[model samples]
Target chain A: MTLAQWSFDLLLAGGLLWLGWQALFEKRRFSAVVHFMAFNLLMALVWVRLSAPDIALAEAAIGAGVTGALLLTALGRLPSGTSSGAHPHRWHPHWRYLAVISACISTAWLIAVVPQLPSPGLAGEIEAVMPATGVDHAVTAVLLNIRALDTLLEVAVMLAAVVLVWSLGPTLRPLPPATILPGLPALSRLLHPLFLLVPTYLLWRGTHAPGGAFPAGAVLGAGGVLMLLADEVGWMQRQHWQRLLRLLLVSGLALFVLVGLGGLLMTGTFLSIPLGVARLLIMAVEIAMALSIALMLMALYLYGEPGQ
Target chain B: MSDYYATVAALLCGMAVIGLFRAHDLLHRILALNVLASAVFLLLVTLARTESGTDPVPHVMVLTGIVVAVSTTAAALALTIRAYERRRQREDER
Candidate 1:
């Protein structure tokens, strides 16, 4: 690598470490959150430096963007007047010092001793079968085709999460949204079409490039969060609308299973697409999953039923 | 250069563990947990770097992990909010 490249990586590494520390050790929870979001966004750049474009996109949308919004919402809901960020320790928590010291020692030792893992693992194998998986992108093929069982389980996990959170009972939504900036509603309205179009474009482009369901769904979910933050989702309070949202949340997992079953019947093995219709089947599952992921993430941001 | 990342990852893991251990607040703990997760993601991706190119398999694993991490974080946040609200409500009644 060039000297310039070396320095760039050094700066990125320093920034990540500093941000990670700030995200936790900072006195204010709010600042910690902001640091955490910055850390994730920087991590996306790290992924790009490592030549992992797919993960870079996913990290940017889901990690840096949606997670920041979720943290902000949770912060608002936390009961106030508590002595936040004030620990009653007489001295620094000694156990923490011990832990960090031991962890660093062990981690350094392990890296020095452990042999490097042979690279090109599974990339060669996955790439060879990419054409059969119906996607030109290796990551998508690995995610949705060759080892689709993992993806299936992941969608199910998303469903389970929504169900668990929903059972936590309704909390109050911030009415009149005292927290949002005055101009955000107008901005959210302006960008609303891009929110819809961008995800669609990503989903369509996923077959050939770095775009795919996870990032697209995350972008859509972030849009939902934007609408919620701007207090423009008044219609979500309707009793019947809750049922529709619930169905949408459940549809991703259900459709994945149904598609898996269909694949089983068509081919002898389950979850394996026939070579002839690989593209069609993968795209179908991807669309259903993207929609479901979008709703599930949005519902998660709601934290509970939308308060009237 | 990737070794530099490995060292960073190691340091992150250590720091995040300390943060997770020392944090008294639920939100602080969650943030530390996330930092820890990012450390693991970084280590794996760095390892996936080969003389030829970056590997796709570990990339897939880390991507799925990112989605999973967000879901769990949301669930944890929801639980935290519920418990805090209930405690406040109980105090009000008392």
Candidate 2:
């Protein structure tokens, strides 16, 4: 909290608010998407300000990068007229705007009053229990150990969502052919190995640094998306990988659940694997999750079959 | 003051909601929703940084939120793509 940092944060928050308002009130869908992207980037900066570098990276990669790509892909699939046309009706309805304003103000007021609220007295309780669980990170302890069941369920939900999407038929559009990037083939050839290096580095760095599964997964996903976008792989070729991709998608959840259950056999508790084993198991689960997430995201972006 | 950053974050959140409400196209709405999610993440992180040292709770919360966000986004995109295909099919028939 230097004055400078404080002011910077204020500027970002104000910018976010302004962008959000503009995006909502704006009539044009294309403009709204641009504004939304801007808003996401600013939000990532806000995460950085909050001392959560891990989240900041995720926001930047997944929230801003991958999400934006998905939106743009969807936009491409839609009929141009539907998005480009003006609304048939005038933008009146002042009452609705008023309502939104009132709701937002009330919510802000409530948040402002949170400081005055009494402490829950759970912080100490949780801290006391942390060592007993053999986990150092309080949040990790809560998410993976104490509330391991919840985490497992959450992973299941993610898996179910992917399955649900798969049940829906042919959503992928034929991507346009890639043109040679001027003098870039040589560069790409040189950089291909570098790209491989980056994701592995990110994964290894996650052990101690702010990077983690989510961000690393996103980066890997982006690489895949880029390859497709560049038409490096033919649609028919990509189709051949579908079965393998499906396995990768579920591998993370499978690893997590199996290891967690193994703990039950030994320790007589779900997700309560021994300390040294737990770290190794969690890391394994994370790697799997990262791969699963990346594939799932890429598939979602690509929609159904690539050729169709 | 820190309030300024909070205000900016709050404002972005508002804009995101506005984008969602105003968007006529499904893709636009999805983008707006992502914006809103980002703003919320920012708000949480900011609030969590009040003390001298960083709070692990918010970091973990944000991490989990990111995974959840991406998962939901994937599902939503899949649904949207399906809807688009069906619409196109109906159009061709007509």
Candidate 3:
């Protein structure tokens, strides 16, 4: 690598390390969180540097946006104070030498191996079958068509997580609305349409671009959390809406399974979308996955299941 | 170039592991855990870069990972906050 390039990478790596240190060890809770968000933002840059814009978008949205919101919300609810009360385990005197020796050995091994590692992946194989997948973007094709079984299980995991959270019941003892911030209604109003508009755009973009269900769903989930945080989604707690919400949450997996079974009936294999209808079917699956993912993430952000 | 990122990612993993153990509480530990996750992602993506072209599979895998990581973090935070709130309420009563 050129000196300039090496310098830049070193600087970026150093920045990440510094930010990580501050985030983990900073005496103040609020500042640590802020530092952590900054680290995620920097990580988005690193993703781009590695030529993975899809991951950069996902990292920026879910890692920085949704996760930052969750940490902040949790911070507000939990007992807030400076960080002097807790204590770390008092390591045995001999532990330090062991830790240092292991650290040195691992570092040496990583340095030796990382530089000589050959680039190996399925790029060629995926490229060969890209057209059959019917998505213009190879990444989308892989996620929605090629390895869709993984996607299927991922949605199930999300469903399980939301169920786990809901089982906790509502732990958030509702505080007064004034505790959140000023001009809250306007912020929520402003963000509502943008959230809707952006995710739809992202959904469309995913067919040929770095956008996909994860990023779109992440933005949608952010909007949901915003609405809930603003306490504007009180209507969701109503009986009629609860059914709709539950349906929205499950529609992804249910529809995905049905489509997979349809593939079985038509092609003698599950999840194998027929070529003639691959594009349309992939779109349908993408939309379903996006919706389910969005709601699942939104559900996870809730203090607990609403209307419990 | 890939080597540079790989080395950085390795160092990051080291730091995050140290921080994860050293962290005083669940919140701090969770943040370190996120950093550790990011380090692993960096390493995987860095390895995807070849003389030919970047791989889509690793990118897809990392995207899925990000979603899973966030969900698990949310679940963990939800549980931790619950316990903290309950403990605080008891302290207030006492």
Judging by TM-score against the true structure, name the best candidate.
1
In model 3, where do residues sit more than 4 Å from their true spots? Answer: A1-10, A81-89, A175-180, B89-94
User: For candidate 2 chain A, which ten residues in a row score worst on lDDT?
Assistant: A114-123
* CAPRI level of candidate 3: medium
Q: For candidate 3, write residues A165-279 as lDDT tens digits.
A: 8888863657224376767778999989999999899989998988878888888887887777777877667666888899989998998899899999999999999989888
lDDT of 3 at A232: 80
User: Cα lDDT for residue A154, model 2?
Assistant: 66
Kindly report, for each predicted structure in the order presented, the TM-score of its chain A compared with the true chain A: 0.90, 0.80, 0.90
DockQ of 2: 0.46
User: Interface Cα RMSD per model, in Å?
Assistant: 2.6, 4.0, 2.2
Worst 10 residues of 3 chain A by lDDT: A170-179
CAPRI band of model 1?
medium
Candidate 2 TM-score over all chains jointly? 0.82
- Residue A248 CA displacement from its true place in model 2, Å: 1.5
What are the Cα lDDT values of the candidates?
Answer: 0.83, 0.65, 0.83
Each prediction's DockQ?
0.63, 0.46, 0.64
- Give me candidate 1's TM-score against the actual structure: 0.93
For model 1, which pairs clash?
none
